[model samples]
Target: MTSFDIVFGSFLVSALRSATPLVFVLVGETLVQRTGSINLGVEGQMLVGAMAGYGAAALWGDPWLGLVAGAGAGMLLSSVHGLLTLAARANQFASGLAVWMLGFGLSAYYGAGLVGRKIEGFGTWRGAGLDDVPVLGPIVAGMTPTVLLALVVAPAVAWWFWRTRTGLVWRAVGESPEAARAAGLRPIRVRLQAILLGGLLSGLGGAALSVDHTRTWAEGMTAGRGLVAVGLVIVARWNPWWVLPTALLFGGAEALALRLQTADAGVSAHLLLTLPYITSLAVLTLTCLRDRGQAAPAGLRAVMDR
Candidate 1:
């Protein structure tokens, strides 16, 4: 391959890899927010998942088990948020923040023993023979299995939200709990389902980080990607279908930052590292200015209305 071709291909590949976790979190957050719940606890959820997944892989000698354990951890924490917000009628945002803190403390306290540890984590999926092809080969060849699964699942989630009877009920519950109750559907129950599912996905993303991306456990390894995903849901206008592109955009910024760090650019390395967060903030600001809550569910509006 030509030098430019190789460089561009590397950038594309890195973008996809970086975007994987965001895609997972964005999809999960979309599901939760659709049901009128804001999950700011994603940062903590991911951290706990990362620790649990890494510890599981280390203990049992299987990375896949780590994925499951991570998801379970996320669900366990999510249940607390659900109980507080849904059962006790607590403020969703506050409950989410509390969950985040709980997760942070729990993970930090428990994960101390796991620092500097390693596991036989997942490997990339190098499509057989495809790596010999032209540009497409380099760009699409070496993705990890979890990223591929996320790509497939994103569309499936979009389909489920738009093309099914159950999906309609889910939307109905989000749009108006009173109307859902009138229609004989329990809003609390549906929302709890959504929140729990979102937590599972978040945990899976965390597992992907520890098992498929970094292959090691570290305190606060998630580094606010969860919060970025929350902003991405907003930038996607709360549509599951739009999450993929939004996540890609953020991933591209991250990849570019890394690329700049390695290049001859005279920029400060720390400044380059800020690109992803800067991009997220810019997109969030622009989206809010343009949309002004138009994409938020009616149930969410009602919560604000109260």
Candidate 2:
């Protein structure tokens, strides 16, 4: 009868799990945005990552290998985009959308026979002698590895963007590509690295959802989480540091909806599940009203921040 206790305790776990994927995706998007480009192919990239990770895991029967393969898969696809935009001088948005289409179509084709496939659980890793220190027991208990990574990555990403010289150049490229180039920083090269790293992070997010979260794979499993991550970039005002809390907000909503389903709220469950998307739109609408649609980074050339 203690609803508070139930939601408080279980919500933490659900939040951790649900937020893991979004954490990775948003952070990656933040990195890419820092370099002044947007990749709308996030949904498609994530879909391909899911298919690749599940397929690799299923075939090799080893989850770690599968995860690595998934990352590689995403990198390969994204590198192609980098080449087109960087080397070939193609329009960034158009090239990204093409990559998205390629990932979606390819993943769907290969995933046709893989739907409904099941995977073994990725259970918690209990700390051994040192990590079991009494003072820190609560800190690490019951946390999936990605959750820990999510926590640690906030500062790492910040350092990558602000403290490092490369980071400075990267931001410069985003804010003013021509200026960056005049300063002897190769815009295409920096952008390519940003794009590649973004793909890697996004791939990890897909792995968390399919392998760690549900332990299953299906067509369209990404379900627009990629798009949500892109939105997170805007909501966070293209700040890597802001992605953490914003990701949790989205994650918390999703966890609440799932919990409602477990409580057998039926129609209400479905409604709650749909709220995150609505919330995203609402957030955009509100931000636009205030900033007149300039919540995103200035000088960042991309398509469809709206």
Candidate 3:
């Protein structure tokens, strides 16, 4: 009824929409970090996935197939990193950066030419059942199905990381690679699996943003959500459970910025837009200082030499 109430209601929905990509990236990053491998090319991965996903969807008439193709693309890119980092014993940071740059070049080359190429018959989440709820309409609670999928995955990921036997091995590799080796587990193998899975999930995040959420292919559509999510993993102390809520918090700040701009409050839009990233930076810096010992993975180096 009131203008402020309407703005606040819209903000919540917008926050949820924005949070979906963050949740997807953080969950995947959570597993990779837990297994002692680091990838900084998430932005690149998402961009590539966006292009690949849209291309696949446009070809297949089924968005689900596009998502699968997108995920495969992500895994392929990450597998290269896993080989370089774990097998060749390359520096994780450097190798990850290389991957990022490679993706950057490839995406820009392809994305520019593909603009306005429509994907006919791609399913959209805009008019699902959620829009009918009196309190949970599009202005308040209507959300893309990808958001629901991500919310479900978050808890499942937390449970798997903390409670399963495979998870134990995953954690062991992160905490003590030598111990994991001595325990009859292959460090390379465990880390490879983690890397692949992480990349897959992240790619799905890209797919969701490109195909399901926006239903369009824009160059650099993912923006920097992937990188922010890497910080989210660090801020959550590598805890999958906590990553969900932290993502929501960051998303909320973003939603507020968008609302303020829409309301034309005379505030600079760029400043409001930077709030989420700024908040993530503050959280990461504070978490690093306050929970140094607890925040880092067992053997993770700030800069991996080998």
Q: Which one is best on TM-score?
A: 1
Q: After superposition, how far is residue 247 of candidate 2 from its true place, in Å?
A: 0.8
Each prediction's RMSD over C-alphas, in Å, is: 1.6, 3.3, 2.7
> Which 10-residue window in model 3 sums to the lowest lDDT?
121-130
Q: In model 3, which regions exceed 4 Å deviation?
A: 1-9, 120-141, 301-306
Per-residue lDDT for 136-205 in model 3, tens only? 4555345656777878999998998899998888898888888989989998888889888888887777
Worst 10 contiguous positions by lDDT, candidate 2 = 130-139
lDDT tens per residue, model 1, 169-262 = 8889889888899999988888999999899888888888888877888888888899999878889987889988998888899889888888
Poorly placed runs, candidate 1 (over 4 Å): 1-3, 304-306
Mind giving the per-residue lDDT tens digits that candidate 2 earns over 1-306?
255644465577677778888888888888887787788777777878878888887777777766777777777778877888778977777887898889889889987877877666565745554334443443356566667777887669877788899888888888888888899889878888989988988887787677677778877888889888887777777887888788877888788788778878756765787977877767766766787756655557444442
Candidates' TM-scores?
Answer: 0.95, 0.88, 0.89
Error (Å) of candidate 1 at residue 82 is: 0.2
Pairs that collide in candidate 1 are none
Models ranked on TM-score: 1, 3, 2
**CA shift of 250, model 1, Å:** 1.7
